[model samples]
Target: MSNLTSHEVIILGGGISGLSTAWFLRQKGISFKLFEKQSETGGVIASEYIEGSVMDFGPNSLRDRNGQIRKIAKDLGISDDLIGISEAFKTRYIVRDGKLQSLSPNISSLISTKVLSASGKIRLLKEPFIEAGSGEDESIGEFLERRIGKEAVDYLADPIFSGIYAGDIYRMSKKSVLPKLAEFEQDYGSVSWGAIRSKKEKREVKPMVLSFKKGIQQLTDAITEKISDHITYDEVLSLKKSDSGFEVATEEATYHSLNVISCIPAYNLGRILEGFEPELSAELMNIDYAPMLSVQLTFNKAEIDFITEGFGFLVPRKERIRLLGAIWKSSIFPELTNKDQHQFTLMIGGAHDRGILTEPKEQVEQEGIREFCRLMQFDARPSVIRSRLWKKAIPQFEVGYEQQKAKLDRFEGGNPGLYFGGNYQWGVSVPDCIQGAEGLAEELAAGL
Candidate 1:
């Protein structure tokens, strides 16, 4: 066996979380090494250029509500390359009665919008009267159904969260997944009232969905550039606690570190902790992941009859469509495609249709394309078709998530110099992952 290499801190998984954490540690002048199983970094963040169109295989864009994301971009020297979506893309669509319906962007339009029925809108008026309940965590569907109505849960919350997590809202925990909403309920006894009060308390900022000139991968690339030297391409086979700290064995060599931070998925981390922390491993192993597939297709502009407007439409389960949603990439970012072509990214196979992930890739693509054509009223064959399947995509914050969180807390407390930070810990968004990394880096730096 090769002699064990040593580092002050070791990061497992070279995804955005790992790369961003390494960048922050380097900024603090802390010593660390990042190990990735894959040959290249970025994990699922992949940008592909086909002919003249640029397609993002993973996340299309990020919501930068706070300036932290912009500061990171500036630090990476890629702020100049940051591109914000057009104001015209503010509108979002949802499938209703097998047709695309635009959601109102303003209060007046919301009252008049056909997305929800008159009875549903009237039910929303009684939201402030709904009594808040105190108890264990509830599913997002259950919470929304109680606060608003079943109509809202079916029409609004379902499609929106499906687009975000590709998860089943009925199984996802309300407090764990949507903490802000839960806080609103707890603070004011009504989500609607709390939202209004909170909005008045805070200054309004224009919402921006941002990406790089090339793609979201630019953010990962810039971070990797800063910390490339400290990265090792190897799969972590096992992790065991030692007297000094922890020893991590990878395919290439074993490494010793005073502190170990895991940026990998929950299931992968569970495998590494099997013998060392069986209880924690059991909890981690129970974390459910939803399978998702992103299908990118290009068509000649003249071949499509429907106008590609706003972002795109999300398919509510009521629509009984195999597709979860589709993002109009060319419309959102004009630079992503050639002037003569339009690009669309269709998402398929969430918790509702996980079996799609097991089917042949060709069948999945065909089904997605068929749904896309049916939804958009297009008949012309796509000029280009490509697909990427993530068997374990987004982690589900299912019922009893608080128990798992408690387990993580206990494990962290019991095992010193061990930390866990990833999309699974905080959130599934790009900004959320970056923020978690920043916080973890600060904690580790402070301890050092």
Candidate 2:
């Protein structure tokens, strides 16, 4: 409706990536503005407090590995609020034969675990003998099957990727998602050999899984407070390359900036660039996302007969259950709820279960509850239930993803003052977004 004065740089979207970029830019004494469509920031990282229970609508935790996140926390003055996961959560389970089985990592434990069949265990021992394939991209399923056998793909790789990406194992690119595994095969001729040799080389500090005393939103809130003066609550309707730089239009006003860092979803970015750069937009459109549902259920700890130890269990595709997996929220972080209650966060509907989203909420919830009861053999009902549907939750790093990524990188290289950052570009984890943002900010600030 009107024109606003141009700024030096405009960072679009107010999620962790965008916000962190702005924070980093501010440290360099650069002039910038942040545009967020929502009244509040943090994107899917939302938290709610209800009746003494803390519920996270999005990510429940973050893995603090390189201390970058801890430094961010310290810088934000919320280091005291950081909480580490319990030691008891070190154990994880996998569903097998309608029962929860312990997932063991070492060879001795793998031989003794009941999760895999005797034949499957035998197949695993053959991994070292299997020859590595040509240096071409392959799906996770294909890579696992080729190296470790089909049993590992069915019981191990499938559920793990499902939990992380809510993705299809047969479609997920091994090079893009699990580069280390790919490298092991290429460098050592076998994953097992590579792993063994790697262990002998050196030991790296393990990353601790963590969260804030309140929730992950605490981090976002802290960043928002630090950069409050630079943020504006306005929706960006469209974008066009201008003589000066770029003209970003909102519903009520237009603003021009010499540089722009788009940190929105891939689909949103594709739409925004449709008119200006159709070819780039077409490449962006190729990036697909998986829909997911996060359902939180609270139950009286005393009434439930099942033991709620460990982080929770993942269901294999062969299980034929609508539910993908459930996280033992209370067990992971006791502060999330009172002593009398245990909370479970269940994830349902992914690439394969897309139809479940269209089903009535009541029906879906009831079905999930029934399935959980049948699997875990629990007879009690949840005292409280909360659910949120994410239509485009996790980006699928499917086969041929590198091509599209390379195309976007080339587009940014060819076009000056246009940059891209988000979960879609580098990775989907909280730390990945922050690290990518920090790097992007440094590059952009240097260019200025």
Candidate 3:
């Protein structure tokens, strides 16, 4: 007889999505065992303190767009550690004409901004007057080009969304990547009008870009602290539909549960469920993940030549640059650095540059530094340089994602006690993961 454990629910994976789901499910009085492959939790939310510098090996900042993450942190009793971005350093920049240019949220800023030419700015201004596009599935690049112009798509849409998804704008679905703008065209017949009306209806909540004083791992560690006993450090080998609910086999033992919530990545989850739900498994495998290289570099404050105000800049693919963009980590949260130390987390490899991940680390780092310095026209080498490679970092929301999502929904509905929730279908952010957890928690609570 195999070593077997039983529970009311079985949660797979130990990333933020899984932990958050487990946290909420437990609140609803659910009995579940969360099986994580890694010995420690926090999955990609890795943070470290080394050589007098605190750094997040994965996501450095968390955007509390829906305020869910903030509340979750407070509930976890780590609210006091939340460090908000410095108000003075909130300005965003983009590369244009081989120089860093300020990028404000206001569309009106385009009038005086050098990021776009007169023709491009005029084209952007005429967005309100442009007729709504045909309600059809379209790529973000195609959608923006139709509404604004090709110039805006290349300069604005390409780099901005690239920074987020690290994906090809021409392949990313507008409905999936940015559903709100797509909805604006469908409902209000004008993107600008929909934005204005939505703002008027809902109170303006400035989304906070924050990180923990210790690092992003604080929230994950705190979650694990509360539910430590319930988590099992074992890889789920496979899951199958069973008479009672589902049979989950792990490296250590076979666990039986009345319900199952899968929070694993699509790529891995597909393999685990392949023997059970082949069709859904096939769909899950269809999703694409972007490779990323997280390169952290620092310099002494006096060596920096350029203005270090606001957020960092994103490099557009059109510029023939290998780097995606970078963020000023020290500027955002002063606690992460030594006194007067300038730190930046530069990004390389994405949908476009998958090959860079396979190259020699020294060569790639050297090239990245050279390009970055030339672009900024600054003359200082980083005193501290650290690099981490993520093979499949973020899932790409490509065209036809809705169908892929619908298939999963069908699987969940067809199998009463089985469910799927993660950053794959829904948006990929700390807040999005939390939001998915809240929804799944309610769903499991009501159903079970």
Candidate 4:
């Protein structure tokens, strides 16, 4: 604990947030060190090569918005390895009445799609006429229902959003979950009209969703390569305010830094900050996370009769299913699997059902398989590559997120040289973290 070294900045956690922050900081030639409580740099962003398949136990893909992913990939000289979704496989499916129904956000498709009833479709058309509510934070579920009708919310919005945040829309904040949509409502008085106007004005392009050749971890690994010397693969025990600056005690040694930035999970950072900032720590702890169980398996094409293009299908809660959704990982990038082998990543449990993690793996797996097989109407036991349960996997931007956001903003003002920014502070996606890291790095570099 006595071995002390001074540095300009110290980064906590080596996930995408920490690594990306370090990459930008290193580019600025800022002297900083990153500490990760793991043997490797990537935290939840882990890739496993087993049975001729690249199984991503964490986020499977990166929806690159703001060009951050490509820019970083170019800077790392790995832009050549980037891949995107095949045009043929861009369809999305949602389960309704225990049947998988394709969702096409078009007038003709909306009228024909069985996911929403005829009346629901009529209500959807009425969105332009519906008056916008008073400006106030509301749940995503409520927002969607008020705008597009409840039927669409149940079959379309619910599962799609749940797939993203692993959260219940009824509890999650609309402002935090869909800021652009919320803004459109406030400015145009109708989300549908606002979207049409934005499109007419060519406001912005939808985010390009892509991933590296290896997996999502490739991005983290690339950043780690550039900043390898600056990272410590040791556990961060505690963080305290010291006479000099911020004192960080890790399992290996104690270090001091003039500036400290947290790129760790909210709960982890909360525990570390308990030593010096008890009130902020309490507030940080209040931010909740969703637990998830991801099962990746390989099925021989001959053994499965049903197969389709596009991303995957999500199981709406109304369908009375324990399975959350399954992504057609092989469809996204066939290179990740062997010839004639299809890989599917099944997700189970979320904010709605944390019990899946504690339940028996065999029972849960069987039930999930039973439901999936019923949907596919196939009878075959596929080879299970890997099944990993991620506890507190994704942060929930639930109701009252503003309070937490406000406190975090004030905390930085009250505490000098102490900054907190990560997925918890901005977004949970890889691109979101990268985008946030870029802005935060520039801000920190200027301050330094």
Q: What would the TM-scores of all predictions be?
A: 0.97, 0.96, 0.96, 0.96
Give the Cα error of residue 344 in candidate 1, in Å: 0.7
Candidate 2 residues lying further than 4 Å off, grouped into runs, are 1-7, 199-206
lDDT of 2 by residue, 1-448 (tens): 3334455688999998899889889888888889999999999898887667888878999987678898889988999999999875777888998888986556677888887889998898899899889969989899899987898779888898999899999998988998888999999898888888877864365678899988889999999999998888998888889987898987768888779999999888888888889988877776888988888888887888757668888998988888899888898899878778988888888887887668887788778888887877888989998888888899999989888888888988887898999998869999999999889888977776
Q: By summed lDDT, which 10 consecutive residues of candidate 4 come out lowest? A: 198-207
Write candidate 3's Cα lDDT for 1-448 as tens digits. 2434455678888999999999998888887788899889987788877656777878888888767788888888899999888864557888887888887777566677788899998898788888988889989998999888999888988998888889999999988988999999889887888889888776356688888978999999999999999898989889998876789888877877778888999988999988997887787887999988888887887887756676788988988889898887776777788776777888889999988768987888888888888877778988888888888999999889888888888888888888887889557787788888889899878875
Q: What's each prediction's clash count?
A: 0, 0, 1, 1
Clashing pairs in 1: none
Task: Judging by TM-score against the true structure, name the best candidate.
Answer: 1
Which model, 1 or 4, shows the larger TM-score?
A: 1
Under the 3 Å rule for N, CA and C atoms, how many clashes does model 3 have? 1
Model 3 lDDT at residue 59: 87
Candidate 2 lDDT (Cα, 0 to 1): 0.86
lDDT-superior candidate, 2 or 4 = 2
Point out where model 3 deviates above 4 Å.
1-7, 204-206
- What tens digits encode model 4's per-residue C-alpha lDDT throughout 208-279? 778777888888888888889888888888999888888998887888877999999989988988987899
lDDT, candidate 1, residue 322? Answer: 88
True-structure lDDT of candidate 4: 0.85
